[model samples]
Target: MGPSRHDQLTIGELSARSGLATSALRYYEELGLIHSERTAGGQRRFARQALRRVAFVRAAQRVGLSLEEAGAALAGLPVDRSPTATEWSRVARTWQSRIDEQIADLERLRDHLTGCIGCGCLSLGTCALYNPHDIQGTDGPGARKLLPRHSRTA
Candidate 1:
């Protein structure tokens, strides 16, 4: 028999198993989100555990985290060590509120579309949804009202 399944996986094998294109996997590597080693032939080889890391990254992306965020989460892993379960759990907990906030934003946007945009009333300019109490929800229309007063950068 050849190597065990837990042994090194070729780049194509990692891509196939992770359901990410080779290019995307390469991009992930470039972003420091994943790691690999080169074979004697200069071919890329990934550890089997990379499958789980890619899945975690995909899940984070689905919940609206940028690759930078995911990479940051993985950054603390020791250079010679794979991420421990505890470390992953910490990362997940850290992003839980962010995921919740994204869901809330989506829900709010959906409600707005269903009620505001879908409203067929003729007087669109004088709608009650805008500038309630003259507080100036937004200077113009749309979710400009939802803009935060603080900075969004890390």
Candidate 2:
């Protein structure tokens, strides 16, 4: 038999349970981060599994993954069923380095917050010594010195 009504949640129910706005749920469906079906009345109904998927997406966001990245990770899971612990671990492992990089970037920003950002703003009196007449502007736009080292071109 097809899934019973109990096995599926109306958009309103899902929104209430997931703590996400119905509009956000629709957006997530559009982004392919979650899926839903239509009832005879054309209202969206989501499988209970969508709750888990929504939670996973929220967790990914907390770790700084973009929606695109979270969608990609979700795509790796089995579409026929929820992912096993091992499957979840496998996908999560790929984000470890990315999370680490974000941590490093935060630490770097914290350490440098009191100093010149080298954006050629020259707002700080100390910029005269570090940037020296906005010389860092010669490199490129943006905060040249404050940007991650890997992002600096010259």
Candidate 3:
């Protein structure tokens, strides 16, 4: 028989199985989120663990993590093997902080909007809360500053 299907998957298989497009998978690889060993003919070969990694990456993106942040998180996992429980937990903790910050920001925005959205001051530059450029939350890098926890690099 030929090689076991799960022993090493081709890039196409990884993309299909992981529900990510070939271009996205390539982008992930370029960002150092995933790895592959090249065949003698220069084709890529990926272990089955890549399946889990891809799944995690897709989920992270859905949660608004930029490719750079997701790549950094995934890079913490062992490249030669599947991720350990501790590694997974560490990533989870980081995500939790991002989610928490997003929640708090949303609550503040909601409260402020409810209190002042229709006060006929949308066009008033002098209004404390209506200036388009004056965002109402933290104004620096990281979760406290943005709506979604995306890295600036991506």
Better of 1 and 2 by lDDT: 2
lDDT of 3 by residue, 1-154 (tens): 9557569989999988988898888887887777888888999888888888888888887767987888878778777677778888988888998888879877877776676666744323333344324545334443233332332321
CA RMSD of all predictions: 8.4, 7.0, 7.5
Q: For residues 14-83, what per-residue lDDT tens digits would candidate 2 score against the true structure?
A: 9999999999999999999889999889999899999999998999998899999999888888866878
Q: Which residue pairs overlap in candidate 2's backbone?
A: none
In model 3, the worst 10-residue window by lDDT is 145-154
TM-score of 3: 0.71
Off by over 4 Å in 1: 1-6, 77-85, 117-154
Query: Model 2 reaches what TM-score against the true structure?
Result: 0.75
Q: Which ranking of candidates, highest lDDT first?
A: 2, 3, 1
85 in model 3: Cα distance from truth in Å?
2.5
Ranking by TM-score: 2, 3, 1
